[model samples]
Target: MNDHDKHIRVHIVDDDPADFLIIDELLLQSKRFQFEVNHISSISEARQELIDPQCDVFLLDYFLGPETARDLLIEARKVHCPAPIVVLTGVESGTLDDEVIQLGAADFLPKGDMTVSLLERTIRHAIQHKRAELELEQMVKRDPLTGLGNRLLFEEILEGSLARCKRAGTRLAVLFMDLDRFKEINDSLGHPTGDLLLLLIADRLRSVMRESDFVARIGGDEFTILIEDLHDAEDALNVARKIIQAVSQPSAIGGHELNVSASIGMALFPENGDAPIKLMQKADIALYEAKRKGLNSVQCFTSNLQTQLERHLNIEKGLRHALEHDHFELMLQPQWDLRDRRIAGFEALIRWRFGSELIAPSDFIPVAEKTGLIVPIGEWLLQTACRYLVKWRELGVSHYRISVNVSPLQLKTGHFVETLQSTLKSTAIAANLLEVEITEDSLLDGHEENPKVQQDLSRIRELGVKIAIDDFGTGYSSLRYLRQFPADVVKIDKSFVSGNGGEALAEPEICRAVVTMADSLGMDVVAEGIETISQLTRLRAMGCRMGQGYLVSEPLAFDEATQWALAGEAVSR
Candidate 1:
């Protein structure tokens, strides 16, 4: 049995017969690979063999009768071709290589520089690389625990479905569902049991959906259903009611009976907006309102949610204007060290001044984040905060630092670390004197290791910039990530101090656990929204060293914050 006996099927897609013979001879001369080659001279013939799995790889030429293989490469992708494609170009050009790859070429080979060994290696690597990519794509598109379509898959299907609905003038519905009080169950039963509950819930959801409908698990306890050929918005309501009824049934796992209910918000195509993201947003808004109504209920995108929609639209418009016109303001709130009785530093907060009216961050920040204006806005915030830190250093508080909040979207970009480094350089601020606050979700994006985020955070830490995990306890990340993160400080969310709203007071034990956990991890804890003297007293007793809130004094301008800091004694007012 010779190793050469194993056949490697090759498809040479070039118009020139002489070039195809040369390539065919190259493959045939390989003693390591038994060659079965096919040649196609025109685009019409190439399209027929594109979906043929008999061909292991395609050697595509750059110029095929004045029409480039670039269009063919895109066509291969559109058809979901399985075989790896290697583009054969006459000359080496860096710009053309990038363009071909982006157009879905597996490898770009310059014909003038192509050797037997190089050709073999290129073809072998392309096949292996494509294989690995396909495997990774399958994993990326599915929920690992439940084996259902994930958000990425959901978006792809939603876009395609929306296109079909638009062309056919058919109606479709997007039902965004959330498990009401699922967190309580998850907390009580542990993650293992919670996972089992989710699988059963996923199956129940699948049973409710028709063959034509699509269901995806967008989050740990949230699912989205896409129903095409919808007669009316009421068709979606019936589906939602069926899903609600199915979810309300009891689930048995590990000898324990668990019960959960889903609240669904429906958005119909054309009615809710023609775009995919727009419809999703409408459904999300309706879901939030449905959640407000109680469990096992359904709400459609209607005039009731229009107020929020209008507000978001207005804020989006205002945000674009503000970013262009430099209408944003930065304010600093003092953080007092509980034990030392000195001002620790100030956390920089952003405010948007729209004409004469001052809009709260609560109203605009989320809008900014959704619109992806956060990245540019975040850069401005960091640069401005570092400048303020320089001002504070000049005001005789060199040891005190300034903390600026960063959205997760900002950290996802690989260039964020460069932004941080440049800001430090431009402002001439000490690295340790400027801190970047990243949310927990930023550190861990749905249990996947985000290399870009981790790399940026690690590089920022190496530059001596202080890293604080902002809104620590309120996020969906696990406690075990504390050791993995390079954070120097953990700012406990205001909800932990303010009792998470409503009349329900926060237990001291819950607050103590977080402080103790951060302490064990060698991270300093800062309590946020410390409005009450009683809350400050409790946190101090709990060994929390620093805090910032209304009690520490509301956000102040440059001169006022400096004056407050220079007061030497911590003022309650």
Candidate 2:
């Protein structure tokens, strides 16, 4: 049909017959548009007419027998009328126009200035403006990358769902999902491939979701699902499992075969939390626990998880305060040289003193790493160890080095080399007397290829500081990785040293291989966790030069470690 031939239904509500006649004549005079007008004389009639979605536009007079256009406009909005309402006023005051417009009227028209062309243009403009407003609202609620609902819409939906569940005495579930190893993939391949993978995973998620369930992409690699009207808690569990399986499926993107898995955490309504924020937080805690266990797993929120989350938050707060004040101390464990039969160096270990309780490194270091507090904390340890080395030199202790463990996050910081150089310049300690120990996994974290990482390592080595791979034979123990890494020492992990019980010496094949490899590469080897004499003797016989464990001495405070160094009794037996 032609645009002019299509009838535009216009509903007019006015008590005065002359006003109705004027509007009717105006519509009839229009040549470019066809209109079918429905005139109602009372508020009751207009309310009933607005219920049926027939009218394309609404024209209501400012006054209709004991009721105003504002009253009828509010009622129309309650019923969600799609047609736009334009107020017809006898007075041409700006205040009246603004009053009507604020009360849900699309626009206002004056009765004296009425013309066929003006009336037609007003109706078309009102309809188009309202449509654009609605479209903009929808666009704001969607994710730009995945075309799924974004975090803002997810929060809105959660608030509404929680209110409904509260009234109906029903249960709801909030599932927080995070893609595992997504950053590694993004860094290894590229962001474009990562974006494609996210889109594919989003499609997979939607394919398995029910019509009533809602899903949203709340972060770069995180999504949230809201399942309402649950009959039992098991229903939520079933949905979480289905999502895990669906997300685990392999997908090919950008000519690369990619496999991704999700860790899901679920929290139920009224049991886990009553508010939207609490529910989301609890689900996130459970999600982290699932990730800790491994990927491709589902974990449900429990009371213990809540307690742990609280404790973790407290620890994070306390750590920040501890770092600000001087609340951390360092202990040194001696590393004995089997060839020289004397103490070679000590590994600097950090300890936190929270009030009267002494928090072990095992308790607080992981929290520091996760919260990015490790960067500052590691710097503190580095400076403290170097200062100690300077003190030992002043005491006439010669031919000894101090080893300080470094976190992967610390090295990832772009200023690590600068920080080390500044520390050395401040302490004036010889660089050769300072050794930095990095875990095996840290070296495998794109260190060989990452120019920033390689540059940092190279600069540190240029300062004459020795680099040792700690916890060897535990993670990424590839011979090629070790050969490519610019390191001077390899510390065989305690697991291999103590694997053979205190019986007849059963040689550890891994230990022998690691020693042989380090020897060929001109790297010194330190055997860690050598508690028994048999373990020590076996390690010494295998050409492992340095050893550190309870057999030498437990991690000692500064004074005790200095006494052991001066006494020269590290291998008294």
Candidate 3:
């Protein structure tokens, strides 16, 4: 390329004519890269020159008459100048370099050390560094996979829109959408297919929404849309329905036919919330309710949803505090052996003690799982349960194992096996005496074949620890999991075991099939939630060897369970 074609247009803003003449001479001597120089004597002249799109870099004098180079730098940035500004200063001070940079100067050069090579290098470095900074900033605001604005950019735009709406006395809407069964597609078809599906979804969203509206991919399978200048709240609903219809259509990706649906929750400006944070939170609450209802549904924010959201936030805070303060307690419920009628083992249930009251697991466990608190809380449970089991063994409780439930989040964390091994090592308990209970839902949707999950289970089993599937029949109940997952036991859900009166069993065929499958696989069967004698009798007939429920004995405190174990009760009254 010719020298002029490789030229960098340089703008010099200095009040001193002599300083500009010296810089112009140095630029001509460099000879490495062509310099097309423009010299302006005042900040006002530089501001006008900054508007030129061809300007590549700026050289500003640190002191320009009454004003400083900092003033001109601010003016350049105000005009959204893409060029970098290098400060040329006559004064030599220790902090002047930092001061110039803090004022947005890309580089600071002292006049005493001015040279042809130094000047050229400083100019080139400043421009290259500023370009990199801009690129990094753009990356931060965008989702790399979907090439869409991310949560950071979404929040920025939402704040601006909310402010505009407040002044115009108009309405805006924030819609939070979460895709349903997206994980299933990811697990079954692979992540490459899932990513392609998300790209297609982003395109569809852009096509359906008006050009004035904004859509952002906030997270995996989660997106947020902003609708401004809305005439009525119903306008947001109509937009939401359109997005649902567009997303629900089947798409072919990566040689797989994929189908997905979205649940959207919307919050209106000046009605649901006035601030960005509050509106986003309320919209999330609505989205959660929509998911609870079913896929492809929409829910508007309500006062009741806010109340629930507040309670959820409180529970999450309490859980964090409870973990740090040692405010959690474990209760052990006995698992009875139908054949031997003795305590086969106990399931360790975690309970949160909030002040004077005890909170049920059903109330807070879901919150923990949702907020990613479960990973830590679950590790605590495993370590504590192992310690308790060691204590029980020292107290002469033998031939009994303690089962701890594992959250799907915990398994997905990629360190469950390490945690289990570390707990066993620290507690010095026999690995075989600790049972890890996972729900069927955790293993469903191709998770059984997931290499990470399979490796985790295989390593755990290799450590001599037993693995059991908890609440087996309640989830997808894929029989493939029995053959694939390294499960030693299957716990039948309580729903099927309950309400079997006279000769009419609630789900006799399903129970028999599960037992038969377990027997064939050489896995032990445990029936959960046996409340009546008839239920227990029915389970024994179905060949379920172990059972746990209210009928076995309510989950007891450590001391009470110790007493029960010492008494060696064969059956509950």
Candidate 4:
């Protein structure tokens, strides 16, 4: 390459015109490096040149008119000039040298000893270093796996895209992708294989999408794709479906074939939300609905989804308030001994009292489970139930147990045992007075073979608390595991008890078999959903030990339950 090919812009700011001309000519004479020298004869001229849109290097003289070169270098910073400033001085002024170096000059050169090679090498090195730094800054914004903009980059770029789209009267699309059953895949196949699968999926998605779209892995098994200039909502949906099909393909790692599906949700710009946070939230809401409907599906954010999101946000806000303010109340429904028609014990049901508004257990339990609000909710229920039972004991009301339903989410938590122990300890309630009611649907998912479901039940049983399989016959109830489970009671679900058309003739035979089965295993049988004398008589005839339903009484608040317990205590006396 020619010397001019490696061109350098040298801004020589000096008080003396003789010193400036001598340096300029010497730089021009160098054959190995060509210098495009800007002779700014004063600090004021240097400041004007610094603001110009150009770069290469600053060869600053130590003294420039009335101000020192250090002062001019400081002025260069105010103009946002990023090039390396090499301070040149004629005299050996140590203090001046130190001040100029500290003031942002890249290097110092004694005017008498300076050579073209030394000056050229320092400027090139500084320029190369600055380029490398800028490149690294750009790389930091990208996801290493997907090579797409990451969350940090997405936030930065989303504003620009929104502004550009709005100016052009266009729309942008944001799609959120969450791989279904990804945890199971990671657990069984190892994380390395899972990571490889994710990379492969990202590649497949990139191949199918437009070049204008950006893809990023936001979380484990979760990715976001942003498409610019998406004029219609259907365009985003089409891309989502394509991604769904692409992710659904079989992946092989170490000779193990893995089949995975994804749930995708999309939100359009200017319509769904005005900001990145709001748009991502809308996509998340749609994603939740997609998962709820079933995986391997795509959902677009509509007014309904936004409404649901608002409602959920309100509920979540209420939940935080409820936890702190003691807005929850416990209701106990009596379980009757089928043979004697005597009250066996009560099942503790949770009710939310938001001022005068009544919130049923069925209303918020599922939300609690999904949001992981169940962990706190479960803790509260266990603690409250235990306290209620202890209070009943203090009032001289003896009871068998207060059964509380445990959500599957609670059973899966690692702190289940500790929480229960703490609750019993705090309330001074006997462990035997507490029963955890888990549903059959939670125990079986069809995909799991030799599941630890029964083992979890056994752990609860080890806690000295009775375990009951509530809504027993509704799930994929394998008789094999049913015989081996650690359940003390099996409450036949309302569906089985009510039967078809309310006749319940077939239900009696089924109930009898279940009771016989429970008896054979030495487990108590509780026929739930009994709402009539005939239902009670039929259950009693079948040798059922306990029955709980609206027939005896619906779930009553703590005060009502206390009154009933007192009345029962009086009757016994």
Candidate 5:
């Protein structure tokens, strides 16, 4: 079918005058069909007329002088003509039609015994098909639910925007937004509620932005908003504030009133970044800062954010390097038996030496935890501590139990029991020597149901690994987890040990009550942060079996700790 077969305009490019006349008469005879026919006898004439934007489809005979219909089709393809060209042919036409279709023609119709209905059908079908294709192409570039550009579309749009900004010397902003505590809501409620909340959030975000701006949800609870044509930093700040207000509005789900908040980080063009990844990265750094400063706030990308992000990246890199190079060191703090007045065990604390600078456990420990470096770091600590136990035995020093603090995230991230078993095998450290301390928050979720935690702790205990509740009374303000778990010891938090007004008076009374409570439960009691002679005396009087603190000496270096261990001979002497 050629261009003239429809109600819309169709260009007819055929050199044969009689065949063109016959086809035109047939189209006219079909009174139900409407078409604007432009007849041309030469390829040059057809190309000129069909090139017009008004031209919809092309009808051409198999052959044109000097330029075969194939040549015209190839040229048409180059010109990006939207029109579909249909070739008219006979015997060779069938074979050539396939060739012509390969040249970008839409379809082919045999000239012999062809009906106007067939011609018209093919023409309408092609137009409808093209329209459908265009629609689908548009949909691919957009997010289905939010109607914002998807990641694929965002890249294309962002590239163009970057180019334009570079040429015009203009400023642009890219805002990275993450819904705070989204996982908590999903776990507490259900996935359906989470989805509903997300949709509501998307709607609210769209309502706040201008038509010139773009927003896209890239992952679960993560979104990127590009604010184009910004006048200044203050303008971008205003948009960020608007975004915070709009998303912070309360969203009701499953008949429950829920308030959701977002952390927004924004980076500007040229100043923050000139590329997509760099821009998004700076925005992400800003978002991290916002989250760190207590969620539900906005942070603009600055050199400070860049520097901090660089430092975190450096730390992450350094950790990986340290592990590869075996640079991490462990310090042991003695866990003393107050009744025996001897070092019964020690707690393994991790430290790092980066060049001449010593990084504290307090600084890099959380960094490791956040970046999932803890899994490896913790494993190393466990193995190294176990190795120390074997070394002490080799040196003929009295054997002592060693305690290690297990991070909650590390516990949940892998097979905790398997990791423990592996470390024991590697270092030949007895299961009884290794004690794992879990905090109260590990079990407390502001609710009573803690089956997973209970089961995990049970499995660890089954493997003969001793369990202790560290910083016991400071968390949850309740004794529910302690009651549920079969913990071997409950270490009183340093806060309680500090005592009121720096006097050991209130502490002894509290320790006496705690000791009494543990006695009732048939569990051992250990006091932490004992510094003064009166405090130690009070603890011993209260029947606390073990204690750890600065009184024994702050967590000491390995050499210092081993020297202190050798001092056991002094006590015997």
Candidate 6:
């Protein structure tokens, strides 16, 4: 290339014209390169040029008037400046060089030491290094599989979009979408097939984007879109509808026809939230609402949703606090031996005390599971239950064992098995003294296929701990789980045993079938929700050997339970 063809446009930000002239003379002496230097005298003017840079290189004075270049450098990086900046100073200080370099400058140079070759080389190297960073950053912003923007790019562009909309007095929307039942596809069809399906979906998403819309993939099956519409967000809703319809259509992947639906949540700018993170969070919450409503649904952020979110956040914060401060209470519900009409064992239930408000497990347990705080909370429960069980055994309470309800999330973590083994060994409690109860639904969801799940259950069984399938017959494939899963007890769900209409107990046939099946499998049956004489009589007649409900006694505190155990009262009466 000729020297004139190798042209460079440089911005020189310095207040002193004499300093600019000296640097300008040094550049004039270079024969290998052509230079165009524009001198900027004020920091306020420099701010404007930095935001919309049109230069290959920027020469910023270390001190411009009363302010340094630190704030300008921060603003440039925040907006993602494409050009490299070399900080210039008349003072020869190595410390200044290091400080300026750390603040996003391409290089540091003392202006008094400049020469023709030194200036040319420093400018070329700075430009090359900045170009390399920009190239790497471009690659980092893109989602590799789909070639769409990733989360980092989304956040970067989101701020710019917000700024432009604010200036124009327009509105923008954030759309958060998650593919419905994506895990099922991944598990059944294999990851390669799932990836093919994702690529197809991404192409369809690209086909629906407008000129002002930016699309990105931030999760495996999650996508986000930014829509800058002039007026109200009807355009965003239309896009959501298009995505649901387009994604729901069947696609042929690897000779298999597969279909997936999208659940989209939309949050408007300046209304749902004023900032990027808040706006995205609100959109995600809306997406969750759409998923809850059903497949292929679109939902908007609402105040009612905010209220619910506030409660969830409150519970989440309280759970973390409880973990730190030891604010949880373990309540024990007595399990009765129906045939013997006496207490057999106990089911350990956890309760939260948040200030004066007593929160039931039904209230906070869902939040804990959602936040993944259940891992530590669940471990604490197990440890406390084992400690109490040992105390009871030492006191010679006439109970068989304590059954602790285990969350499916806890088992999925893969550390629960090790934690259980450790707790058992440390407490010096026999495996028979503790029974682990998992919901029938968790098993029905193909959890048994997971190696971690299998390892946990098998290892626990190997340790001689009994397993009980709690809330039986409540899930779609509960009956199917029974064939593959081995358990010592089956607790029939309350919905089947509770009375409805004129019938003394609802779904008597279901209860009879469950009891009969458990018996055939040599698994003991516990009929839950026994709240009356008639229900208890019918369950005992159905050969349900053990049960627990308010009819026997409500869940009691530690002291109350210990007292009840020592009393050895008849629970059936």
Task: Residues 1-573, candidate 5: write the lDDT tens digits.
Answer: 454443677677898888888788776766555877878899876665443436666778877766788878876655445577788875543377679878877788888956888877776776767667657856887777667667766665676667657756888999989998886687577668888888889888889999878888877788888888888999999999998988988887899899889999889998987998789878888888889888688899888878887887888899999999999888888888776567877888888998888988776876798798888888888888888878877777746777888777666664666888877777666688778887765545422333565677788898788988787766543444357776888888877886553757345566787788788878888888887777888878778888887766677777777776777511321
The reply for model 2, stretches above 4 Å from the true place, is 1-172, 176-204, 211-232, 247-263, 274-281, 291-297, 446-451, 499-507, 569-573
Point out the higher-scoring one by lDDT: 2 or 4.
Answer: 2
User: How large an RMSD does model 2 have?
Assistant: 8.0
| Clash-forming residue pairs, model 6 | none
Query: Residues 415-529, candidate 4, lDDT per residue (tens digit)?
Result: 7777887777777788888899888777554114224555667777887899888887666555665766778888887766765536443377778878888888888888877
lDDT of 6 by residue, 58-173 (tens): 99998987899887888778767778889988887869878878889988888878788988998999988887887898798999988989999998888877766765678999
Off by over 4 Å in 3: 1-146, 150-171, 184-199, 250-260, 268-279, 411-416, 443-453, 499-505, 571-573
Candidate 4 global TM-score = 0.61
lDDT of 2 by residue, 1-573 (tens): 467535688888899999999899999888877989988898987876655547888898998888899898887665556678999989768698888887889998899998989998998888788778767866999999998998877877787677668767999999999999886787677678989999999999999998888999997899999999999889999999999899998888888888888899999998998888899989988998999999798999998998888877888899999989978899999998776658888899899988888877787887898899999999989988887877777888756788999887777778888898888888888889889898886677647436577567777889999999998877744666577778999998887887565532344888999999999999999988878877777878888888988876889888888887777666343
Global lDDT of each candidate: 0.82, 0.84, 0.84, 0.76, 0.77, 0.84
Candidate 3 per-residue lDDT over residues 1-573, each given as its tens digit: 465535889988888899889999989887788899988888867765654446788888888888888777776654446688999888988998898788788999999799999988898888889889878867899999888899987887787676557656899999999899887677566678888999999999999989889999988899999998899989999999999999999898877777789999999998987888999989988998999999899999987987898899999999999999988999999888776557778899998889887888998998998899999999989988887877788899866789999886787788888888888888888888989998887766337435687678888999999999988777754565468889999988877877554434467678888899999999999988777777777778988888987766889888887776776764333
Question: What TM-score would candidate 6 get against the native?
Answer: 0.80
Number of backbone-clashing residue pairs for each candidate, in the order shown: 0, 0, 0, 0, 2, 0
Winner by TM-score between candidate 6 and candidate 1: 6
Candidate 2, poorest ten consecutive residues by summed lDDT: 498-507
Worst 10 residues of 6 by lDDT: 443-452
Q: Write candidate 1's Cα lDDT for 533-558 as tens digits.
A: 77778888888889887765888887
Model 6 clash number: 0
State the local distance difference test value for candidate 6: 0.84
- Candidate 3 lowest-lDDT run of ten: 499-508
Instruction: Estimate TM-scores for all models.
Output: 0.67, 0.68, 0.75, 0.61, 0.62, 0.80
- Quick one: best TM-score, which candidate? 6
Assess the local accuracy of residue 556 in candidate 5 as a C-alpha lDDT between 0 and 100.
78
